[model samples]
Target: MANRSAQDIRRLNRFEVLRRFHASSGPRTRQDLASETALSFATVSNLTSELIGEGVLVEAGHAQSGGGRPRALLTLNAERGTLIGVDVGETSVRTELFDLALGKMAVDERPVTPEDVTPDQIADLIEAGAGAVLAAAESPRSRVLGAGISLPGLVERERGVSTYSPYWAWRDVPMRDRLAERLELPVHLDNPLKASALAEMWFGAGRDVDNLVVVMLRSGVGAGLALDGTLYRGATNSAGEWGHSCLVFEGRRCRCGNLGCVEAYVGTAGIAETLRALAPDDPLLAQADGAAASLLTGLAARAAESDPIALAVIRRTAAYLGAALGNLVNLLNPETLVLGDQVAAHLGERLLAETRAALAGHTLAQPLRAVTLRLSSLPHDAVSRGAAALAFEGFLNDREVFGPVSRTRGVKARAEGRG
Candidate 1:
């Protein structure tokens, strides 16, 4: 939670009004906002007028049937500006463009292998991707309010610095300045998992849920924490490093050279490693030749044919991840646990069933019963989309950058009905 102060109370109140209005099912009148936020109508009215003056919200129109004088409706003004998102994943850079309401307008992607990725190379990819997206969208470059980059490492967002990035081999780089210089736009940077969690809160499976945890399963395991609709990064911004959390006591070696980490047993790469370790003589491991996707596909194929070895591997993987899920449920007791990313793509019903059973067995009965577990219904591009939302949200908060245009003027202009 941000530190509240007498000086910033009004700012915070305006932000709250904007957030509530944005998440609402439709444009909300002052009366509606007051009811939803438990604030007085007078407070909501002043806040909405200020928001309209700032071009953040517009008095869209009156409700069709309010009986008497149709109450004015306020909606987020889509013309405020555009937001850009770049997802720097394990092996690719994806950039996306979005309107104020989180509607995707265009996207572009570039590939970069993890080992060879460098700061300059990654920056080049981001620039190119953003350029491609903007060109495709035919949006004027000046209209882009800002850009956001979601990396796969620890970040110091306050300084716009990436403390460390394992995927791109970067350390203590002034990433925000570099991107801003290249793109000539304001930028916000954060962890991809954080972006993903924000995406879930805004558009994906965790939508409408206040307390939620978004788990990304890829070569490793990680989590995104949302506390009361806010992304909760730990003191060091390493809050979701569940991949590095130890699960086994002196167990198998992890990629991070740790013993008994949960990720070593439950991640897609971890499952592949386990397959190779346990099935040295099996044809499946030989067929995959160490590709994570191929290995998972091979395991799924054999499991489909009722291969005991394959089924056992999957069952064990499920148990480990389920145990990890149990830990999350107990600790956070979130309203939802969302499984997403590439690893989730390979999970079959059998894996889910085993995971569900393990979760039920491991967690406290009450929380387990209350929590809903669901597979991610988001597209493979969720990371990029989430990053875009991060950019949009960052842009919205900095009110100094906005200029005031009175609520009455906005309503009068609307009466003229200009698109």
Candidate 2:
């Protein structure tokens, strides 16, 4: 009975250590965990042993000590489990597999035409992609702890539902439950922009910063706000719908039935339409029917090389983005402003310069100096990575959620101790 009780206590301590590890900093030693968790050294040691035995924690070299042998440092084993991330965008679906350490093992992307694409199709594609990635990594599907799907719309994380996606014409979709049912895994659903912000917060530029604004200018414009180290998803999970913000008094009509919205000017369709108007004689229009992707890729390439028409389109879009960013900076005063999207990555230095110049002209010199503006490093796969990170967060929080085998082992340990 005493040994059984000790095993129970150690199991609880293991859960506590994993929970705290997600939020805490630096490599933790047994002593460090003992002090932080308010547990005795013997308890800490036993719990650490359990975690190490389960392959959840590993000795990552050692820490220096004033005297005697150095203490062994422990960290979560990133390769012990797998996480799957799905990015469901308007034009395409991207799926990625990552290890617990957050290393991307494999990625797959497929073009999605909404007219023919159904929720089932999207989910199947994600499953296939994840399976392929796992096969490539030689990892078993049973080892996948959790999966997260990032959608381009308002998402209620707790309810695991998508409230709306004007682009996809979806409403009240039970995205999480459906994916969970299909994959037989714990699933999480979130807004693509919010996922992007989370990715930045944990792994990218916003890692050390507390307050940040992540502006994603992809096929559409969206923003994610992180303040004081926590994500700010406003009432009804519609906080960062910056794309719908009114920019012009009576500008072009938006698909959302709004006039002069930022999306009307900067969305991929909007840009392509603008390009069509500017270059009526261009051959892109002739091939638009069957070669849209190639055409867009070509146009993006031309823009990167400073083509006059493409540069003009990019300049105009950047100006509008800058204007909106200035307002955001003044309102939020975030420590860092991240520009994320396909366009930002393609244009690179030129895009940054234009965005900076626009901000300089609009924002106050003092505040502008304080705010660090940069493009995202994970340009193509950021949203997908964010989804994986969400799963990683869940994995690190509770072993039962990720490591059912370990939970079973803990139970067996208790029963045997009692026996």
Candidate 3:
């Protein structure tokens, strides 16, 4: 049994090596793979053959040789498997399909109305979006590896449940099981902020940095933290609830029933409300009572032009944002600070400037100076891409991290009358 287990472990490692090789370089010769993975040529050749036989890999072409025999190049067969990534936002659902190589093949979106959107209705929308993308990509359903859903909330990843979502009014929802059943595929779920952080770690600004913080400022605010090269999900999987952090002791009331929370000042609704109050006669503000996108666009345009009222509102918001960020910086001392979401998309540079100024005014210059503050380059799609990345990582790492070991242990215990 010990020998068999060892063989299994070795096979898993070989499979991982092959996957990583293909992931990084698209295709490579057996000799090149051996060199890259630091495995024996015979081991590489054998594993490549096994993966090819399994239809996970294929011989793409021959590699050019210097003087000896040309080597056959192996590439991942993307058509062999698919993965779905769904971003379930407060007002919309975005879905994407990725091939085994993690290349996005297709994407679609649907608007969601708050009054009529239930958890199950939102789930159906996600399912429909995933199906649409898959069909558009011409990928067979049988080849789907899994689906990943990302939302704004506290997700208990272990239980596949959403503990709470303030935006969606969801509590104790079994999001993963429902989606898995509906789509007939394995499902993974996570918070949208954390998903964005994972996306950053995999392909964005946080790639090389170990200690980092990702603050997403959109309709709402949230943070994703990476500490010591691992995501730091706190005791209840709600570590980086930046939006709810109280900036003032006796300030304005927030939707989360808090006083002077960051969201009360910087959230889309809050900002729009402030704008309306300040400039009651402004045409944009007059027309933006319940229109989120229009209000945001108008606000962005005014801020970009440095309108006095808009600038004042933005500056005040920036001050609060900066103060909050300073506290976070002092606590974590991260290597990078990523600003994302809709607000960041428009006002990132100015916000970063003000945040830095506030940090300089408050914290010690040295530690804060080392932290790189920047905005997300992936606009409009950060959460969705991040959701997709969450799915990808779950598929790749679940077995190693969470999969059950030794089926015989349960059987043996039962046989021994211990159960």
Per-model root-mean-square deviation over C-alphas? 6.4, 8.0, 7.2
> Which runs of model 2 end up more than 4 angstroms from their true locations?
1-55, 64-69, 284-300, 303-306, 396-419
- Where does candidate 3 clash, by residue pair? none
TM-score of 2: 0.80
The collision pairs in model 1 are: 53-405
lDDT for residue 258 in candidate 2, whole number 0-100: 90
Q: After superposition, how far is residue 332 of candidate 1 from its true place, in Å?
A: 2.1
- Taking all chains together, the TM-score of candidate 3 against the true structure is 0.81
Best by lDDT: 1
**Over 4 Å off in model 1, which ranges?**
1-3, 6-26, 37-39, 281-291, 297-310, 348-350, 401-419
Q: lDDT by residue for model 2 over 1-419, one digit each (tens)?
A: 24345445445345455544544566799988777655667767876887788787899989988899899999978778889998988777898888876678888887777565667777787777777788888888898989988987788877888888887677888888888888888887888888888777766777657689988876678898887656778877788999899988898888888998887776666666666778887766665443445555776788767789878766776787788788888888888999887656655666677778888777877778789999887657888988887776555445563332111012222233321
lDDT of 2 at 332: 87
* Model with the higher TM-score, candidate 2 or 3: 3
Question: What TM-score do all the candidates reach, one by one?
Answer: 0.87, 0.80, 0.81
